[model samples]
Target chain A: MLKLMQNEWMKLWHKKGTWIMVGILVILTAGMMGLMKWISLQNMGGEMTREGMIQDPSSLGGTVLLLTVIVAAGIVASEFSQGTIKMLLTRPVKRWKILVSKFLTVNLFGMFLMLIGYVVYLLLAMLLFKSDAGESLSSWSVWSKSLYMLLLSFGNVFITSTFAFAIGSVFRSSSLAIGLSLFIYFTGSTISALLSQYEIAKYLFFTHMDLTQFETGMMLVPDLTMPFSLAVLAVYIVVFLLISFSTFIKRDVTA
Target chain B: MKPVVELKNLSKTIRSKKIIDNLNLSLYPGQITGFLGPNGAGKTTTIRMMVGLMKQTEGDIVIEGVSLRDNFEEGLSKVGVIVENPEMYKFMSGYKNLLHFARMHKGVTKERIDDVVRQVGMQNRIHEKVGTYSLGMRQRLGLAQALLHRPKFLILDEPTNGLDPAGIREFRQYLRKIAETEGVSVFVSSHMLSEIELMCDRIAIIQNGKLIDIREMSEARESFYYIEATPAEKAKQLLTDGGFTVEPFTDGLLVNAEQHQIPDLVESFIAEGLQVFAVQPHRKTLEDEFLEMTGGGQIAEAYAK
Candidate 1:
């Protein structure tokens, strides 16, 4: 499985699009920070400090989700489009193992982007901006808060990409997967808000996708705890994976 | 010789329609077997089942003594496949593409990778991206990847689809060398009957999802010589008198004769004042035999019934 993941990673990095993704992540991270720096320079609203920006890295979520979804959508679908799926599946490795490795590699790519974005954010925050007068940027609470926020931001990326990966594999169309996943990501919260009064809202995956809502004190759905949300997301993720793996392992590779 | 791969009562039914029906075949080591069938005759379906890309609804594929049904990875590890065009990751360098495939099979070392690249004569542009490669170069890279693990059995579907004549000859020689030296079993499905005629030692023909015939290329076929002579009737009479079966051919008479008796017959024609314009050995091509077997690529009468 590790060897298979290595193969997936090698294929992933060899593409010019993947390198461009990383470059975009770094540039966007810098651009967002620069925008924040400029906003602080304008001083139109209340003071925005480096510690505060680091503590809430939700701004990275949209870019990360888009990038990760693009990759997850293509990782399996591109194999079909490129006609390499036959070459890939005809190997000694089992079908499920190949699917799992691709899944792992997609998430790994997402995490790598998240980490790089965070590091860039951290570097610029330290280099170009000052902390609030009484607070140190190196404070343990601030560091933990930023790291935790990064993890929560990644939760949305993880779930969205997995959704895209599942749809991509099952339907064998990258465009459909990317379109549907992004559609869900953009509209899930509003849909959940519309249905929050019903009991079915608690069971809906969209209600729990924004795990950061718990930290932001903005509850889209009332009386939902982190553990319950985690459990619901876990179930959704497992269902998505089950659909991906079963379809991948069983479908005839005519291509 | 024991068979390296066996398809036992294999069948595939998709959407209540039988694509391949109870197919049975065995491929021996050190022999190249050609698979020929018209389009949608289940050649690709059978090959897919053998390589585990498609599951057989019934029966088993045993490769190198391991049943694919029981141990897919173990069975496939000993097999190499190039189905249709060798679709590669055009985004990657040829060497990286090889490395990616090399990692899938166990015990394939970096040295083996380089060895395969050299064998395919891709040393100069091994590091170049596959997108820059021509179709011939991709085919070479495809073969290189398939041979990376030194498989015991190699399966090729239209293996020479895009190669030039020289490349095809070289590829044939390479296949023959591997089959001879390393004792590898090869199964190739191709539409190029003449190419198969030249490359394969034996052929297994399928029509309407049935194995119609399997024959050796080296097997002795009835030899006929086309004799184009002036006054064809006189030549026919002379050949019939010589106890040779004579059949009318275009502007000639086809006489079934042995090579040793050909000179004597020619002498008899000269002595009898028969002008023999052309005398050449006429052998049926694989295409002719294939068409005859498959009934001009139509649905067989048996199936139609």
Candidate 2:
């Protein structure tokens, strides 16, 4: 299994699109920080501080999610499109092992991108913004809060990319996976809000997708706890993974 | 000799239609077997099942005495496959592509990879991207990757689909050498009857999802002598009375006779006042036998004579 993941990682980096993705992620993170600095300099908004921006890393989450979704969707679907799936599936390794390795590789790439994006966001925030409330950069309280926000933001990226991966593997089309995943990410919260008064809203995965809502005390559905939301998201992730693995292992691989 | 691979009562059905019937076949070491059939006669489907690309609805495939259903990885570890046009990671170099596959099989070292690369004569271009390779080069790389683990059984589908004459000849010699020196069993499916005739020791014909015939190439075929004589009428009558089932061919009569009896028969025809213009042996080609076996089925570009 470790060998298989090594193989997957090698193939992933060999593509030009992967490097392009990393470049785009860095540029976008910098651009977002620069735009915020410009907004503050124009006296058009309240004072922006490094600590304040560090605690709200959700701005980078959308970019990480998009990049992760692209990788996840293509990791399986591109094999079929490139007609390389035959060579891949005909090896001595079992089908489930191959699928698992690809899944793990996709998440690894997502994490790597997230780390890069956060570092860029941090450096730019410190360089371009001041400490409005005189908050120390090396303080433990600020670091933990920043890290916690990053973790919550990653949760949203993880769930969305898994959904895309499942769709891509089951349908064997990256475009559909990316399109459907982005659609759900953009509209899931609004749909949950529309049905917030109903009991079914609590059971919906969209209601729990953004775990950061618990930190901000902005509950989409009333009386939802962090543990309850985690439980619901766990079930959704398991279902998505089950669908991906079963379909991948049982596929005919005519390509 | 014990067989290296066996297919027992294998069957597949898709959408209420049987794509492959209950089929059985066995492949032995040090032998090269040819698989022949018309399009959609389940040639690709059977190959897919053997390699685990498709599941069989019934029966089991046993390789190296291990059932694929019971344990697929162990059974397939000894097998190597190059399904039609081995699609590789075009972005990576040929060496990396080989390394990628090497990681999938156990005990395939880096030295083994270099050895296979040299074996396929791709040492010069091994470091180049696969996207820059020609079809022949890609075919050689395909063979290189398949042989990286030194498999005991090698399965190739249309192995010579895209190659020059020299490349085809070289590839054929390579397959023959492995089968002989390493005692590897080979299964090749091709639409080119002539290629199969030259490369295979035995041929298996299938039609309508069923195995129709399996024959050894070394088996003696019936000898035929074409005699063209004028006063063709008297010649025909003489051969008809000579206890031979004579069939009328172009400008002559085809007599099913042995080699030693030919001179006497010519002499008898001369005495009957018939002029023997042409008397020579006619060996039946594999194409004729294939057409005859498949009931003149629609062969894809096989009748390009």
Candidate 3:
């Protein structure tokens, strides 16, 4: 199993698509951080509290992590499209082992990129402006919020990567998977808002994906707790991974 | 000799269409068997079934005395396969691809990897990315991967699909050497009959998902030969008188004589005032036998009962 994992790790690094996705993640994360820092500096004359800025960092990390999901989805989806699955399957390894290897490698890559983005965002935020004039930028609350954001970022990327893997397995086309993933990412909140008047629409995976906001005490809805959202997100992750595994195991490599 | 791989009453169906009929074949160890067929003759499907890639609707594939369906892992462990086009991570170097494959086998060593790379004559370029390698090089790398595990049985589907003449010769020589030196049973499917004739010890011709015939090359070559000579009528009489079966052709008398006996027949014809224009040998190639056994006609007709 360790050898199989090693092989999968080698394959992940060797795939050009993975590196391209990483490059895109770095660029887009840096670009978003720069843009937000510029906007904040331009509005520096107004009152800016340290507490507000600490609260705002979660949203920033959340949004950047969301974009990272899209990038990671493309990386995972291209393997199916390029017919590399055939080569992987023909190896004398179990189907489940192969799936787990890929899942682990992809999440590891996502976590690495998330760390890079977080560091860049924090550096830019600290360099650009001072918070609340007299308050120190280094505090336990600020540190706690940053750690929480990183954990949430990890969970967000993990959930999204698994969902994209499922999409890739079922659709077996990178274009379709990327298109549908982006469609869901960009339109899910709007659709959920429109359907909020209904009773059962709140149970959707998209509705529970922003569970981190609840963790940072930014809940817009009553009675939705951090634990409840995490549990729901965890269940969705398991379901999606199971679906992906089943589809991948049964799929014939016609390509 | 015990057969290395055996398929008994094998059949496959996809979407209510029978892709492979009740096909039976046995390939013995230490022999190179060629799977000869035209396009869509279920050759690829049969190879897939043997390698556990596709499930057979109703059949049993015994690899090294183990059932493919019942003991898939053990059965698959004894076999190596290169089905369809060679698939690899094109971004990685060829050496990396082989190393990745080598890790899948239980006892393969790093030295084995270097040995296979050298055996395939790709040692110098093994470090280059697969995308930069030519199609022939990719094919060689695929073969190297298949042979890396030192499997007792090798199953290849159209292994010479895109090879040039020299490349084909090199591939045939390599296959012969492996089968001889390593004592591995090689079952290769190909449309190139001449190559099969030069390489295979025994061949099975398939058409429209059915096994038509399995015979040794020597036996297949003994069917008949076309012989041409001047004074066809006299030549026919002389051949008949010499205890040989002769059929008159437009320009010659086709003889059912052994390859060595042709010289005697030719000399006899010359002594009897019959000038020999030509005594060309026209034995049926594997292609000709395949066409004849498959009821030479449209592919759909070949499938018809």
Candidate 4:
């Protein structure tokens, strides 16, 4: 299993697309951070501070969601597209092992992106601006919020990759997988808002996607809780994996 | 010779339509076997099932005494394969690609990677990215990857697809060398019959999902000579009278006689007042036999599409 994961990791790194995705992540994060800092510096409504710049919402969601969708969508769909899936599947490994490794690779890559992006943006914010958020930027609340944002980014990546991975596996079209994943990411909040009247909307995976919202005690549904949302996300993960692996095991590589 | 791989009554059905029907075939060690079939004859389907890329509707593919159906890991570990185009991560160097594939197999050292790289003659550009490679170069890199693990069985589908004649000749030699030196049983599927004639020891042909024939490439061919003599009708009569079957061709009489018998026929032609221009041996090419077997449907054209 470790070997399979290693192979998957190697393949991902070898792809120009993976590096391109990372570039997009870093550049966009820096760009978004810079813009937000400029807005804060204007000091029209809120205090402008270096520590304040690190707390932008784009760390977890927004444009980063597109990168996650792409990374996720390309995980399995590009294998089929590029015909490297045959090379992978022909090896002495279970289909599930390969699938799991790719799943692991995408998430690990996402985590890496999150951690590095956070640290770099943190450093850049400290270097570029002066802060008055607390006695120091390392205050417990700021650190806690940064950690919360980390969890939220990971949460978003986990859901987006699995959903997109499932779509890629079943549909075998990266464009379609990415297109639909991004569509859902962009519109899900509005859709969930419209559907919020229904009691069942609270259990929807998208309703809990913005994990940072839960940290602020702003539950989209009154009954929504972190534990309940985690449990729901867990179920959705199982469903996505079940669909991806089952289809992969059964489908013929005639093409 | 022990069978390195065996397909026992393998069948595949799609939507109630039988695509591959009860196919039974076997491959032995230290030999190259060609899988030949016309378009939609289940060649790719059977190959897919052999490598576990597709599920067989029935039966088993046994490799190195392991069942592909019952024990996939054991069966597949004994084999290395390249199906359709030689697809690799184009962004990676040829050596890195081989290294990645080597990770899938146990005990595949860096020595083996370099050895296979040298074997495929990709040393100069092993560090160059695959996207910069031509089709032939990529095919060589693909072969290098397949050989990296020193698998007991090697399967190549349309391996010579984009190679030129020189490339094809070199690739064929490498396959033969691998089979002889490593004792690997190689199964190759190709529409290039002339290539199969030179490269494979035996050929298993299929049409409409049924194994039509398994031909030995080393089979003794019919001895035929084209008598290029003038006044050929008179000479043909003399040969027929002398108890030899003589058939008139476009430019000469085709005599069903061996080389040792050529001198006597030449003498007879001289005796019949015919000018003996030349006698040319009529070599029966594999293309003629393949056309005869498959009813003139060009198999290569199917894949060319």
Candidate 5:
């Protein structure tokens, strides 16, 4: 099983897209940082502060979600598209093990994107901040709150990415996976807002995905608790995995 | 003969249509066995079942005495295959593709990787990305990856699909060496008969999900002579009277007579006042025999004068 996992990692790393996607995200972060520098130069502001620079890319929750979903969606879908999965399956291992390794590679890539995003945020903030930047962002209370919000956002990103991975596995089309994942990611907050009037909104997986609301005390619906929201996310995770493995294991790869 | 792989009444049905029906075959070690069939003849389907890519509705593939149905991992561990084309991570170097496959099975070391690279004659370009490889090079790399574990059985489905004539010959030589040196049982399927005739020791001909016949090659192949003589009709009659299997050919008669009996045959023809113009070995290629077998065309008569 470990060997199979190792093989999956080898395949993932060998793909130029894996590195390219992360590079694209870093470039995007840099682009955003550049815009910040331009805004600071305009001198139409109170001194541009370090907190504001750090908050720029760090607040890119939707962008991170889109990129991560692409990573997660391409994991299993491209194998089918490229026909490499046939070679993968013919090896001396079970199909389930192969699927597990694919899932592992995708999840790890999601973590990688998060880490890379975090690093890019730090670098851009350090490099682009003005010499006369306002007060340093050193308040421990603000730091703790900021840390909680960022972790919550990243956690939600992982959850939605898994959802995309499942859809990709079922359809075996990366385009469809990316399309629907992005569609859902873009519309989830609006949908949640509309559904907030209904009591059953607390039960929707998308409603609870943005766990940052737990820290902000901004529940989508009345009487929604952190544990309850966590439970809903957990159920979604189980359902996503079940769909991924069941469809992957049972479908015949005729192509 | 020790069997490297055995399929007993194996079957696969997709969408209520039977793709394979009760396929039973035994592939022995140290020889190349050709799987011959026309298009959509269940040749690839059977191979897929053996490799566990497609589940068999009914039957077992026993590789080294392990049942594919009962223990797929163990059964598959003894087998390796390149289905259709050798699809690899095109973005990666050829060396990396082989290395990734090596990690799946135990005991395949760096030495073995280098050995296979050398075996396939891809040492110079092993470091290049697979996307840059020619079709033949990719085929060779595919074969190398299959042989990395020293599997007892190797299955190739339409392996020579896009190779040139020279490339095909080179690939055949590689398979032969693997069968002889590694003692691997090679099950290669193809629609080309001349190819199987040259490479395989025995050929299992399948048509419409059933084994048509198992024909042996070389010493086991049928040998005869094409006897062309004046008064061809009478020559055929005389030969038939002499207890020989004679069929009319466009030029003369095709006589299934042994080489030693040729002198007597010619003498009898001379005695009958017929001029013996041509007497030569009439070797029936696999294509010729298959045409006769499938009733697609007439034999001996089909060949031009």
Candidate 6:
């Protein structure tokens, strides 16, 4: 199983599209950071304090989470579209191992992409918005929050990637997976907001995926706990992965 | 001889349509068995089941005496398969693809990978991305992947489906070599009759998910002969009258007879004032046997139409 995982890693590395998606994440994240920094500089007036003018690095987590979702969707969808899953499954390894390998690779890619995004965010914030009247460097508490947000961002990415993987396993079409993923990611908050009036809507996977908000110490519903949301997200991950693996093992690879 | 692979009443149905009926087949080791069938004749499905790629709706497949459904992973480990187009990561080089598969199998070393690359004659181009390879090279790469683990049994569906003449010949030679030297039980499904005739030691004819016939090529070819004459109908009648079953052809009549009876047959034709333009022995090509066993072109046309 470990060997199979290693093979999956090699396959992920060899795939050109995986790298292309990563490049896109870096470019988009860096581009957004650079643009935000420039905009903040332009708004700086005579009375503007260094603290007000400096771009908050914590906001970088939001952009990283968004990029992670997009990258995860692409990685899961492209394998099915390219028909590489056939080769992977025909090996001597177990079916579940194949799915687990793919899941691990996608999560690893998500983490790598997030790291790249954070680095780019730091670079852009430092180069474009550095202050002569330096504000105190971010406190340990702020860094801890940022780290927690990053971890939560990964969990969010894993949940979304697993969902996409399940859909892609069933549909085996990249376009459909991409369309569904985008719909869920972009329209999820609006749908959640509308459903907030109802009791059951809060329990949806989309509602709990926003781990960033939890890390920022904000809760739309003060009664809802962070541990409860995390637990629900964990359940979703396990169920999605189980379904994906089971379907892949049993489904015929006629394509 | 102990069979390397056996299917007992194996069947598959998709969406209430039975693709493979109660199919029974046994493939022995050290023999190249050609699975001959037309398109959509459940050849691919049967091969898929043998390799554990697809499950059977009814019955079971036993690989090396182990039930495929019961111990799928173990059964699969003993078998190497290439179903239809051997799809690989197009962006990855051939060497990388082999290496990746090699890692999945226990005891597969760098040397073994190199050996397979050399065996497939892909050593020179193995480092190039598979997308850049020609159809023949890709087929070779697929073959290399199948052979990477040195499986006791190898299952290939339409192994030469898209190859050119030269590629087909190369594949046939390689398969023959593997079957003879390594003693691997090779089950290859193909539509090309002549290729199978030359390549397989035994041939299994399948029609509409049924195992119609499984016979040694020599034994099957021995009972049939193609004889050319001016009037094929008369020649067929004469052979039939002489206690031999005959099938009329466009240019001649194919006679089912023994080698010793050929001279007498020609003499009888000459005595009857019917010119025997050609009296050569006719071997039943895979195509001829497939057509005969499947009830000719009408069944194929009905399916197609």
Q: What are the models' TM-scores?
A: 0.94, 0.97, 0.88, 0.89, 0.89, 0.88
List DockQ, one per candidate, in order.
Answer: 0.82, 0.88, 0.49, 0.72, 0.68, 0.61
What are the Cα lDDT values of the candidates?
Answer: 0.92, 0.93, 0.74, 0.83, 0.82, 0.75
Stretches of candidate 2 off by over 4 Å are B230-234, B299-305
Best by lDDT: 2
* lDDT measured at residue A219 in model 1 versus the true structure, 0 to 100: 96
Query: What is the Cα-based lDDT of residue B198 in candidate 5?
Result: 87
Error of 3 at B231 (Å): 7.0
Best-fitting candidate, scored by TM-score: 2
- Residue runs of model 5 more than 4 Å from their true location after superposition: A1-3, A31-58, A123-140, A217-219, B218-222, B230-232, B297-305
lDDT preference between candidates 1 and 3, better one: 1
RMSD of each: 2.6, 2.3, 3.5, 3.6, 4.0, 3.5
In model 3, which runs have C-alpha deviations exceeding 4 angstroms? A44-77, A131-139, A215-223, A226-235, B218-225, B229-250, B258-276, B297-305
Give candidate 4's error at residue A107 in angstroms. 0.4
Please list the residue runs of candidate 1 whose C-alpha ends up more than 4 Å from where it truly belongs after superposition: B229-247, B259-278, B299-305
lDDT of model 5 at position A165: 90
Candidate 6 lands at a TM-score of 0.88
lDDT value, candidate 1, whole model: 0.92
**Deviating ranges (above 4 Å) for candidate 4:** A48-59, A127-141, B227-255, B258-280, B298-305
Instruction: Give lDDT tens digits, candidate 2, residues B97-130.
Output: 9999999999999999999999999999999999
**B14-41 per-residue lDDT for model 4 (tens digits):** 9999998899999999999999988888
Candidate 6, B1-305: lDDT as tens digits: 99988889998999999999999888888899988877777888887777656778999988888887787678778888887788888878888888888887778899999998888887899999999998888889989999888898998888897899988888888888888898899998887778888898888888777888888876634566788886766777788889987767667777778888888989988888887777776655567657877777555588888
Model 5 residue A24 CA deviation in Å? 2.8
Candidate 3 per-residue lDDT, tens place, A148-199, comes to: 7667656655666677767876776656665776677667667766676676
User: What is the lDDT, from 0 to 100, of the residue A31 in candidate 6?
Assistant: 78
Look at candidate 2 and give me any clashing residue pairs.
none
